[model samples]
Target chain A: MKRRRRFHIQPKHLFLILLAICVLLIASTSYNTFMTHSIQGGFSTVLLPFQKGMNRLGGLVYGKIGSIKELYGVMEENQKLQEEIGELRRENTRYQLQLKELATYKELLKITDEYPDYDMVGAHIISKNSGNWFSTFKIDKGSRDGFSVGMNILADGGLAGIITSVEAHTSTVTSIIDDGRSVAAMAASSGAPCMVTGNRLLLQEGKLDVTHIDKDDDIDLSYKIVTSNTSSEYLPGLLIGYISDIDKDTNNLTKTGKLVPAVNFSRLDTVMVITTLKRTEG
Target chain B: MRKPVFYACVIAAAFLLQNNLFAAIPLIQTTPNILLVVTFVTAFIAGPKDGMLVGFFSGLLLDAFFGGSVGFYAMIYMAIGYVNGFCGNYFYRDFVTAPVLLSVLSDLAFGILVYFFGFLLRGRLAFMDYFISIIIPEVVYTALITCVVYKPLLKLEERALESSKRSAKRFV
Candidate 1:
């Protein structure tokens, strides 16, 4: 008699089945949609305190190390700063004398008299995304701190990123150098427009790709790139990077170049969120 | 220590160290994945069930804190734990080779899976650059850490199991 053996599921088999189910579930959903309001949100909410405490501890340790290192550079930096301040004082007096001339020049140029007032909020980076690339990081400040998705983030005197998501106590910043991030940029000197986009290849070399420049535009080394006046989301005149290695595209109608990003993403620890969103100008 | 609570504390502590302390270290960057080491060691020492549980929770914690996708890392880590757990029976308290080899294999799998699903699917095709620049460094770093942390983790596993067994005996 061929009696059917009793069916039994071993723990390993059960684990494999569960793993398959999870993989299939993730595969079926659109990645972007599945990320929002999913179990991750709850986990973030729960782990906030621990992350915050750990970050504070790490910050304290890093601060001490930084202070020791800065001791060696302090005298040199002080001398340099004093010299610069003296030069700036002379320049300020000279600029004061030329204020009337500058006003007339502004009028002739038809430039706006008032600049946008940028409200700022400071935040500490609590953790980075689970990858080798420093593309995304979570800050301790969140919606409660008046931070929200799409607010521009700045670090190290450069436009860093835009807030991608916000929870109550933390938010995520997707940096300008991240794989999918793109910024509308222009040469600060000539106001010639271009697009700066993140490229992994360029990121390895600590640079970004600047594309769509008209072939005739005389972009050159050391030219500053800033957010374009045409960018709807980012505020105009925020420094993005410096242009380098301008080369014509294969089509020859346009040019592309590499930009050394102003923000050193690897050293990011703190950032300022420009609270005010940019209004699209006509 | 109670097994479940021990696992929870260790995983939480590992998460904190990975996100905060190790991440803040300049030379380390994100190369040494401390949590991955914990997952690999736990799976290697305790077998499949423990491995899956550790992987799921740690991966979920990682995803929850900094992940874009909720289940992406959780799924990857869980698979890694399960696969590594197969070698659990062959583990010896004094032997480090199995754990080290398993760590390399697991870390390599993680690097490939992440590259395949995250970058390749998204049209990033610079395989040689990525393999050399990111994948190799991370795998080597993770494996090196495994060598350092393996003995301690095995000891921890032994104590936790012994305590659990004692509790079970008392219940009887």
Candidate 2:
């Protein structure tokens, strides 16, 4: 069979063979939606107990390491806070201090008031998606208590992926890193919008591309990109991250930018899920 | 006839362990190429035809489980077994460093094949991130397991042959 390579495949013949096989596999596996779900469910049930047990074991080990690392961040932050406190004490400007407090209070109130209807159940992450799970994670809570599929998950910064699958005790948060996820986001600065995709293939270029950007648009670095509230699976104003780079279409109205997700996803340990944010309009 | 059944049992047992027991090991982030490792080792130990068949079946099972194109696993694994068998006939089976090196290489090759085909299906995706974010970590995890897993699996292999249970032969 060893000979000089010939690159030609008779296209019609090859196409037929491929089509025939696809039909065969589909016929074999696709009994019905219910049947498919049941089979997947059966396999998932077998896997879930294993996944949960491993998650707990890994959580214990990582938790200790995380606490140590957190302790170090806390000490560092405390020293910085102490310095700030000293400055506040020295200035003793009651009027300015009150202004700062008032602004922060207003912001916090707005966030709470906007979502007063939803109950918040906070969760601590126990384990990453083992290998290649930079895009998905497991939280220590699940459905029997109240969580369900398609719940909006967020942390201090922005929207996480929806809960694709939920067990009695845990839910899988598919991250923007998941190949299956995409978000419609816009530049907070330029008002230009584009699709923010989470496929890891862009990591090869060291960053993701927000394509179809307008060359004439005011695209700049650090332009805040948030989920476009109008037509997103995410609630409005949840920060995904800022644009670290801008690819302006000088010739068109649309602009695209590189997203640097706000959350330090590498060490994400805790997350907040908004269980009840729904549109009351039409 | 007996050898085929024996090999089939070994492959099934490996799949069961991969889906079940291997999860208990901590910080082992590699994509336990349970099927890949078994197919390669079996091809190395048995011969080309048996190894290739085993690998194809294992790959088929992997495809069914992981939600990808069906024959993709078979294509890569059968190649692995075929090549491993080709090498087996010539190379010393006792080379201590060989398993580690061979595993890393095969997984990488398998990963690249996955990426190449995945790219064709889904356009304009990140190849390096998939490699760096997913594949490399999995390879390292798989490589590390070789050290711990090989010793025990080898002993079991010896015991399996010694016991010769399936053949109605008494344990020697």
Candidate 3:
């Protein structure tokens, strides 16, 4: 008779197997292979309904609590806003006159408008990433809603982020405040180019790093910064933020500064996604 | 089989709370890592095998939801679970200090691992700033939440184990 052998499984073997599996998953996901996409898509589709229900329930509960808290401060806030509105109305009249003059100038120069009207869809934020390391969040709109990767998201009347991933019913957005993200921006007045980079540490102060500005650039504090025309992904002329401070770099060739982002990232609820992709020349 | 199902449900619930309810609460500056707490509690009660399994699945859930790469969290959490399981010999159902302490350390480990992979690997060498700002606050928050979370999870694990043992005895 042939000798019978039995297979034995140990904890060491299990650990090695798990390690291998994790490595494989990391590799596959990094490459963004079809298998990884399908798996993520499948899981997202299954979880979408439950997540939506949870989101609504959480919103209702939080809304009740927030309203109660707001009751205490509403009167004061209303008075302050009334004064602000009066000031803004005066400012608006002056801006209207300036705009008319600018329009006349544009007509004389025969210059085309830089800002294009974009087709957009509004989306509600469903949930945010659990950890503080990344400022990515999921929104209710997805591929079904005509959202695709790299579509610019606008919130609070400025550029918020770009769509990074999309499933059937939900999509993920990496906000401008996230680490490692950079936007090509320019001073609205002088058109001097700079790079606005995200830093989580600076996020506590509601600022991002504005760097790579030429030493001779005339950009100064409180200057309005908008997206540059040369940006590969973002449509040009969307508002980014204002320059808060500028400093001479040690290298003397470039200057660095800080910017206050236009969007209030802490309370992003609803955002508009520009559905048009930036046209690229081949 | 029943035990696995129970743990899976618990992990799923923690995942939802971490991403949704806790995240929405404006009172807290940073949301606690409840899934990490669950992993630590599981590893503290159960042996390395169960700990590793729970950690792997929970980490995978996080990866599926938000991770750019699928297995970064999975590997870190699995190692945490396996290491914490070695402390099971000192575990008692009523005691809370060990679990609380271990959770803090594990959270720190998680933060450091994230910093290493997410920042350092990308040539962002600002470790001191990250440690001071992001890592410390998260560790403190997760530890405080652990005090509230540990007892309930221990009770669930005990009940599941007792039922499993009873079923096994019946088979014999």
Candidate 4:
């Protein structure tokens, strides 16, 4: 009788394959928090030049499109701007005096003075997650530039996001608006503490949800919200947003409202990463 | 026409374009998943093994760029590519339906997995809201991109395959 022919993957190969997958899964889960920084950095190093070239090309295309759109509106915009410029110049002098006075007061009070060495590195927003807009974005600066996880990112306006992952020459920023965790915030007026959280349902309307406000707190609509002193990750007093549309919870204990994020996440081009690590001395 | 080198170049270009060029185009609210489309196209043109290989590398590229974990996207893309590759046998070269349908299904899978892992596990229980708002629109957008990109990629694959055959004949 002829020997029976068999076609099957050996058990040893199957075990090896499963083992490899398990190892990869474990490694990836820890990648952001702990392990694999060097490996991730290496990948970023390879991708840096390509990313830079592509970013330049993207900017060119965007500029052309913008210029074409501007052509039709230029005349009307010019007229409006010309009329406003004269009035704005007068207001600017008055504002400059007030700003100088406020700066003197801030210096006297030692506000934001704790971190005297606070410095920032500027980076261009190179890429965004296509599926989720600003949920995660790549910056041109990274670990090589002294960036690390948990550092705060700010845009022209205010607190843009936080650095969650760092590579060699690139880092990924998860903006405060994306649906994930919440940030501890305090009302600039009443000192009432709250939580600013990303909500997808609310984000379509260009807003985020603020929770944990005391029901009886006289929180005014449009009151400025800033990072709370109690916040472990974010530094105190960074502007978060302005609160609006407060509603009491069914339990009548806490209030929830909407906040208009300070950073216009869609138009973000340049961002500055606050390299100062939150003082862990407490 | 060197298969490995060609595939590598194509995947890298696709990754860059997907993240930067197409991402900047605000014509659509949600950017189309060009890398995902490329992975499926490779599977549709090549067989399962090649599809899996391409899918793994493309997913790895994505993960390397922005993924929270290194293997999350790679595993998902590999699974999608392998399954799509089985559909290759029934694929007619000129037909557009296969890619469109495959894109929709694969995107749906991606959305479910992402939501499950990223949100639900993290105690964000608003499944219906995310599914309708983000997941559905993304699936539609990705499918639309498939309609435009399918033809060129198919042509490229045909040319590459023919050239490789000629080279192989010469070698023999």
**Backbone clashes under 3 angstroms, per model:** 0, 11, 0, 0
Q: Tell me, by TM-score, which candidate is best.
A: 3
Off by over 4 Å in 3: A1-8, A67-116
Query: How do the residues B1-172 of candidate 3 rate in per-residue lDDT, one tens digit apiece?
Result: 4788999899888888888877766566688898899887888888787888899999988887788888888898898888888888876658788887898899999999999999899888989999998899889989888888888888889889898877766665
Query: lDDT tens string, model 3, A124-222?
Result: 888888798988988987898888889999997789999888888888899988998999999988999999999888988989999999999989999
Model 1 sits at an interface RMSD, in angstroms, of: 6.8
- lDDT string for model 4 (B49-92, tens) is 66777887887777666776776777777777777887889868
Q: Against the true structure, whose DockQ is highest?
A: 3
Model 4 agreement with the true structure over A88-149: per-residue lDDT tens digits: 99899999999999999988766542334568778898887776523788998888799989
Report the error of model 2 at residue A282, Å: 7.3
* Per-residue alpha-carbon lDDT of candidate 2 for residues A27-116, written as tens digits (9 for 90 to 100): 555444333333334444444555556556556766677789899999999989987997777678876888999999999966743545
lDDT of each structure? 0.80, 0.63, 0.86, 0.80
In terms of lDDT, the poorest run of 10 residues in model 4 chain A is A2-11
Against the true structure, candidate 1 reaches a TM-score of 0.82
Model 2 chain A: worst 10 consecutive residues (lDDT sum): A32-41
Candidates in order: C-alpha RMSD to true structure: 6.6, 9.0, 5.7, 5.6
Query: Cα miss at A128, model 4 (Å)?
Result: 1.7
lDDT of 2 at A266: 55
Which stretches of model 4 miss by more than 4 angstroms?
A1-23, A26-28, A31-34, A73-117, B26-28, B166-172
Best by lDDT: 3
- CAPRI-style quality class for the chain A–B interface of candidate 3: medium
